[model samples]
Target: ALLGQQETNLSDGSQQRVTQLLKTAEPGGLYGAAGDLSDALPYRDRPGGLRAIAQVHDRYILAEQPDGLCLIEQHIAHERVLYERLNDRWQLVPLTTPVVLEGLNEKQLEQFERLGLAPEEFGPNRWAIRQAPEPLRDRDDLPDALLELSLGGNLDTAQVAIACRTAIRNGTPLDLATLQTLLDDWQRTRNPRTCPHGRPICLTLSESSLARFFRRSWVVGKSHGI
Candidate 1:
């Protein structure tokens, strides 16, 4: 499904791939570029390589590659980036004004605390956050992450779910600067092909695969969210 009504998330391909290609770096590791692809696509190059040209359907980032064009799913691309980034060992950051979270059961509270959220019982089924992981703290939507975390059964699953919640959603339209920055970060991720949850991040429609192709760039602004 392109849009998930329950969580406002997007899911495609019910079949999850068994093979996982995680970065070689340890947990909490920062990934470097994977270098140029063998197919002569410079999508990973920083100084000069694939260039952001347009956005398609206001969801996919359109970039110009030597072979043809690349369509990167913005949501999954950011999801993968956030997922890998959250994979690193967390650095706790205390909030200026402690945040309160609700809708968590005792078990969920324990699991939330286990993820080192510094959870405290505020009241009946309410938890307060004394400190948060560094990556999560920077986000304006800490509550969103906490809400998503409440559904997690374990640390890893919770982290992945939190990343999905925190990442830029599919309908968001990013400016060229934002798209370029996102692409740079996406290229740096070790597993750019598929997100941790098994959704495709980037799709290349090479010249060989296209009978005809046209690039169309829409206006970049808030009214359109492009």
Candidate 2:
């Protein structure tokens, strides 16, 4: 099949390498022949099957996976982590100063309280949050969070709002240790592919893709006969 408009004009040497790469790129071989961690991911492989190289643009976590490279959006990854935690454990912590959330109607406040927000009437058009989910206790965007929850009446949506508010925001520089910890926790989650909003958290670039970009032949094994 034709690759694309740009690929049709490759030089003879580049075309040869591309052909070699395509022939060696096998399908359904991600985890190798055994299709198990034993063969696919050896003991000496990078921890968690990947290593955090850097924080790109202070928002995404640039990591190197065993088979390729990946970029993880920090905010969404943390949000997914927090959402699962809140959903399963339902942990709550008291706020030292009750958070006053404005722009919520009385009925909305009632719904918020039912969803574990623990908000009480503070003043006109505002509610004081005595206790919040552990994830939300440190967030300063309570108003926005409350607003996100106000529109929904289900527990699932409430969890999303709490997670979004609690997760580390974009542009916040994370140290290598912290980034690794976050990625480690993220890898353990039941569903780490997407966030609460259904946004992809990780973008992967396979080794084959890299080879194609560099116009180099990709060898299947460690053999160096060529």
- For residues 40-100, write the lDDT of model 1, one tens digit per residue: 3345554335678887777999998777777788998899888888887646788887889
Candidate 2 C-alpha lDDT tens digits along 1-226? 2234435776798787975554333222343542221222211334488788999999999888778777889999999999999889887688798878777766786787677777777777777877766766676775566567767668887788778878899999999999998898887777776788866577666676678777666444534777
Instruction: Give every collision pair in model 1.
Output: 28-87, 28-88, 28-89, 173-225
lDDT of 1: 0.69
In model 2, residue pairs whose N, Cα or C atoms come closer than 3 Å (at least 3 residues apart or on different chains), thus clashing, are none
**Model 2: how far residue 8 lies from native, Å:** 30
Q: How close is candidate 2 to the true structure, as a TM-score?
A: 0.66
Task: For model 2, give the 10-residue run with minimal summed lDDT.
Answer: 34-43
Question: Local error of candidate 1 at 173, Å?
Answer: 2.3
Mark the regions of model 1 whose C-alpha exceeds 4 Å error after superposition: 1-48, 123-125, 138-141, 211-226
lDDT of each: 0.69, 0.72
Task: Give per-model TM-scores.
Answer: 0.66, 0.66
